[model samples]
Target: MINSNSRSVAALVALLVATAMPAFAQPPASPAVPAAAVTSDAGVSGTAGSSRDAARARRKANRQLVKRVAAVLARTRGLDSSRILIRAADGTVTLSGTVPDNMQIPLAVNAAQQVAGVTVLRNQLRIGMRME
Candidate 1:
């Protein structure tokens, strides 16, 4: 002889309790991962050493090319070798510093281009005022 509203409330509470009971219960334990299945660090040193050696060889070749470009520029006519700064990387030569006249700029570039290993030439020379 309960009121219908009260009956509905009681049924709702029972349903909620039944649904939440499993959520509060402890779950079954899972097996641990096997050690053999875990990933390992391999070939770490060999890969690093090979890259280092390749970089070293590249730098050595760049240094030799720089020397060759500088020597050629020093021997070019109408250019002051002492006033020019030369730097090379990966077969590219960079010429910087001030020269006595604007004509020396092209002269320097031409000399660097004549070198066997030069792939690019960068001219950064400035023409200084004539000395009396």
Candidate 2:
């Protein structure tokens, strides 16, 4: 009976140690990622930078087109270029605001279309014909 009680106590102690070992153990370290692997072939950062650059270039080109179209309209005879408003986006030009006469609407649209880099032209000009 004495020998059996000693064995039972030893087994209980072993069981307690087994359960406590994990609480004292250190966590496993995470694997490190290589720099080359992280940046391999058009990674997220690289692609985003390139896309931003492309967007900037497109915006610059559109601004240039707006200037060119505005210059053409300014040079056109019998058209009040000051009253005409020009906006360009993605090579598309929008001509808006009041023109002195109805004939100037087509003139302005044609002038904008003749300019290079104009993919689309939207004419929103209204004639403010004077009664006087």
Q: Write the per-residue lDDT of candidate 1 for residues 31-132, one digit (tens) a residue.
A: 344555344447556655675687679778888987888888888877886767776777877776668887888888888899998898878667554333
RMSD of 2: 31.0
Q: Considering only N, C-alpha and C atoms within 3 Å, which residue pairs clash in candidate 2? A: none
Model 2 CA deviation exceeding 4 Å by range: 1-42, 129-132
Worst 10 residues of 2 by lDDT: 26-35
12-124, model 2: which lDDT tens digit per residue? Answer: 77855754464356233223444644443545778656766876797788788888999999998878877777878877787877777888888888888999888899886
Count of backbone collisions within predicted model 2: 0
Alpha-carbon lDDT of model 2: 0.75
Candidate number achieving the greatest lDDT relative to the actual structure? 2
Q: Per-prediction count of colliding residue pairs?
A: 0, 0
